[model samples]
Target: MAIPPHAQHDTHATTRRGGWPTRRISVTALLCALSFIMTFVEIPIFPPAPWLEYDPSGIVAFVAALAFGPGTGAIVVVLPWVLKTLFSFNVWGHLMAIVANLALILPAALVARRVRGTRGLVVGMVVGGLVSLVASILCNLVVTPLYTAVGIADVIAMIVPILLPFNLIKIILNCVVTGLVQRPLSQALSA
Candidate 1:
């Protein structure tokens, strides 16, 4: 049997050279560990909801997604989340956090893979930021009441004043920081 021309050409996009699967698995594990550590290093930047702290764990998954692919990036997000939940026992929070992380990562990685180069990355991040912000808002609106004693009215009230700004700041921070580091990291990984 013969491989198609397009399939042969695109194989390199999906697979790296030299022990490719092993390399992805190892890096995914490393990224997951880093993300787990990051959860502990958060700052209470949002005063309206001080409990809604800021952490850069998303960056680990984003970088992994940018380098290896979405599946590996997902492993980075999920494994840490599962382990963290085992200790914290916050199942709903963990589930929602996964959704939030994927909102940014999926779009950015998909765009980067499809478009290529710095331009693709920038466009992807911008789109991902918007998507993440919206997803965060929607998730908070829907899921906040389930976790908290607060009513839907109170949740709605907090959306603009609290959740919106909090998510905006977080998404922008992720975008800028990840954008700054992604190129160098990609080069390093490829090398």
Candidate 2:
């Protein structure tokens, strides 16, 4: 099948010496910058865990993945935290965010790449959202205790009451926001 218009390659774009095209690199950088800036603009959702904040950087990464493919999207996912780690030295949370965002974007980007159209997008997002939820639960099980004073049992207890719902809400919001902007972003990039 022909590639969707949104997936169409930029004909004039140069990938000199077989490297990534300038446009792709620029877009990835822009997305990473946006993600980095977004980290500071978080909102606390659960009162019990006032420290856990929701940042929509994942949505920007997801849009990059959807527009450029999952592998490139994965780079976009990691770049912000990699940059942040340089200054903050907070490895655990950044690592968790990397895993969570990758899990969130990959399923949707891979599926959408194969299955075109609106239905495909919705299916991909739903599958990706579920993947994010489960991966986050597993990641929290392992990573939370290492970083926080809380134990595994406490983390487990918080899963159903806090983590599960919070992750769901986060992914859903990312999905909605990405769905709104990805098409236009893709089209503009392709142009």
Best by lDDT: 2
- Residue-level lDDT of model 2, residues 104-170, one tens digit each, is 8999999999899888899999999899899999999999899889899999999988998888888
Candidate 1's clash total is 0
The Cα error of candidate 1 at residue 26, in Å, is 1.1
RMSD of 1: 4.2
Candidate 1 accuracy as TM-score: 0.86
What value does the lDDT take at residue 191 in candidate 2?
A: 66
Q: Worst lDDT window (10 residues) for model 2?
A: 10-19
C-alpha lDDT of all candidate models, in order: 0.82, 0.85
Identify the runs in model 2 with alpha carbons over 4 angstroms from their true place. Answer: 1-18
- lDDT (tens digit, per residue) of candidate 1 on 83-166: 999789888887878888899998999999999988999899888888988888788878888988988899889888998898
Q: What is candidate 2's CA lDDT for residue 119?
A: 84
